[model samples]
Every structure is written in C-alpha cells, then in structure tokens.
Target: MRTLEALATGTPLVASDYGLEGLSVDSPGTPLGAMRANDVDEYVYAVGRLFQDEKLQEKLSNNGRALIENEYAWEQMTQRYEQVLLDTCSKYLVESQE
Candidate 1:
C-alpha cells in the first residue's frame, strides 16, 4: 500500500484499474503517464515505452527508487509498524502501550 502511494506520488504506473480498485488516489494515469497492464501485452507495451523512451526510463528510475527509499526500505517500513502500534496504544491507553 505504501509503495503504491509512493509510486502514485511519483511517475506513471502500468497497473490494472482493478489493481488500483479500492485505493485512495482517484487519478492514477496521465496523458503520457501512468498506464494499466492488465495483460502481458499491456505490460510489454509499457515496458517497451520505458526502454525506447529515455524520458520514461528516467521517470521510472527516479520514482521507483524513491518509492523504495521512502516506503519499501526496511527501516521506513519498520517505523510505520512501530508508529501504528504506538498510536493504537496511545489512543486506547492500554497498560501494554509502553
């Protein structure tokens, strides 16, 4: 979920609308950006676009790596879980909150 959010915040995505279904962001595509890869062909097309186009590669590289750094990174993800637990306990005031 966090990765998706990060990706959305960055470059275009090649994912199914169903893949995007039940998510927060409404618009995930742009005129020359984010696309849906519901099948092998769409995926190949999107990837081809990335490779054949230098700008696309730059976009994917920058955005995808940023996603990894910001969300998929082990330390960052761990922090999210830790914060969730702390927030839950703080809200409920449980003895185990410590």
Candidate 2:
C-alpha cells in the first residue's frame, strides 16, 4: 500500500526486491518504476544513481505514477475485481446447467 501511495504521488523509488514482491513493476521488456536493491551496498548504489541522474528520476516518477493510475487506482482495481466476480459467476452458472 505504501508503494502504491508513493507511485500515486509520483515519488521516485529505490526499493528492495522483497518490497516489490507481488507488484507488476517487474514485467519483462518494460522499465521498472523503482530500482531494485536487495542489500546495503546495492541500496546505496541505487540511491546514488537515482540522485545523480535526472532522466532516470523522471522516468521512474512517470512510470510509477502511470502504474498506479493504470493498475492500482481504486476505480481500476474495483473494475478488475468486478470482472473476476462476474466471470466466476458465469462459469459456475454454465457448469451447473451442464
């Protein structure tokens, strides 16, 4: 939830792999919204890189915000959940009729 909040607020992130678990931020062939850093040294390097690179910061900020707006927003999540429920109900109805 904190990660979603940060993304919603357009904050650039340097997060651990564990921190990003279960999120869609690591899709293949796509830029990540946050830099993944597992250890102290990796965290330090990622933070330093984030601080020093303006373009990277902008990219991360935009990607993160877009991710939240597209996938994690209340409206979006509600729609997805509603669709899942509808699909499940439809499947159950069809199976019962069989």
Candidate 3:
C-alpha cells in the first residue's frame, strides 16, 4: 500500500526486494526495474541512481503514476478480487459434481 501511495504521487522510490509477493518489479515495461534492492549496497546504489539521473527519475515517476492509475485503482482491485472469488467458486462446484 505504501508503494501504491508513492506510485500514485509520482515519487521515485527505492525499496527492499522482500515481502513483495504480489508486486511486480524488474519488468521491461515497469518503472520499478532498478528500485528493488536486495541489500544495503543495492539500496544505496538505487537511491544514488535516482538522485543522479533526473531523466530516469522522471521516467520512473511518470511510469509509476500511470501504472497505479491504470492497474491498481481501488475499483480495479475490487473487480479483480470479485472475479477471483467467482472463479474459485465455479471451480469448486465443478469439481464437486465429478
């Protein structure tokens, strides 16, 4: 949720690589490619990169904001959850009939 907030606000971010089971990083079309840090050195490097490169920062900020607005909005998330529940129930019903 913190990441979502930062993305929504167009903040370039550096974050730990752990605990992001559902969050995607390091994708070709994603702004989080270089922002996932596995250690202190990687974290420092990521922050330094953001600090030194204004163009990169701007690109990440724009992409992050767009990603959140398009994919992570509250309505979109709720729809996805509802779809998952419906699919799960359908599968369970089908299996039980066999």
Candidate 4:
C-alpha cells in the first residue's frame, strides 16, 4: 500500500510483490525493489528503469493514484463491506426461518 501510495504520489518507491500480495506489478522480481533473493540486481534495474524512462513511470504513478482514489476510498470500501454484511445477515435470517 505504501509503495503504491508512493508511486501514486509521484514519489520514488521500491516494492516487492510479496508485501503487496494480489497486486502484480510487472517490472522487477518484486514489484519495485529488493524482495527477491537477488533483489539487488532487480532493485537496481527497476529504479534505473524509472529514472531512464520517465514516461512509463509517470504513467504508472498516475494510474496508481487514480486507482486508489477512485476505487479504494474508505467510504466506498466500507459501503461494500456494509452491503456484504447486510446481505449475509439477511440470508441467515431467511434460512433460520426455515
């Protein structure tokens, strides 16, 4: 989350996919930096890629921020949770009636 947030902020970030499970970032052995056993190489390469290729990094950073801001806002997230909980409880009540 932090790495993604950093990326979203246009701040330099390095991340291993392990910490950010389920979110696959296609770049290094990890997502951004040192997470692999030979992470040093992957890390250097990933960061270097960002420095060397400004456009790609900018795209990722903007995309990341847009994603979180639009899709993962706490209000929206909690609404999803509330809907799920309400549905589950409703189902439980219906089944209990039987």
Could you list the CA RMSD of all candidates, in the order they appear? Answer: 6.3, 1.8, 2.4, 4.8
Error of 3 at 41 (Å): 1.5
Query: In candidate 3, what are the lDDT values of residues 1-98, reduced to their tens digit?
Result: 78778878988867775534456655676555237787989888888988899998987788778878888898999999999999999999999999
| Model 2 ranges with Cα > 4 A deviation | 95-98
- The ten-residue window of minimal lDDT in model 2 covers 23-32
Residue 95, model 3: lDDT of: 100
**Candidate 2's residue-wise lDDT over 1-92, tens digit each?**
78888878989987877788877776797667888889999999999998899999999999999988888888988999999999999999
Model 4 over residues 1-98: C-alpha lDDT tens digits?
A: 67556645755455665654565444445233222223788888877877888776766666556656665678878999999999999999999999
Q: Candidate 3 has what TM-score?
A: 0.77
Model 1 misplaced stretches (Cα beyond 4 Å): 1-35, 91-98
lDDT of each: 0.63, 0.87, 0.77, 0.62
Superposed Cα deviation of residue 17, candidate 1 (Å): 5.6
By TM-score, highest first, what's the ranking?
2, 3, 4, 1
Candidate 4 segments whose C-alpha is farther than 4 A from its true place: 7-13, 24-38
Candidate scoring better on TM-score of 2 and 4: 2
Top-down lDDT ranking: 2, 3, 1, 4
**In TM-score terms, which candidate is top?**
2
lDDT of 4: 0.62
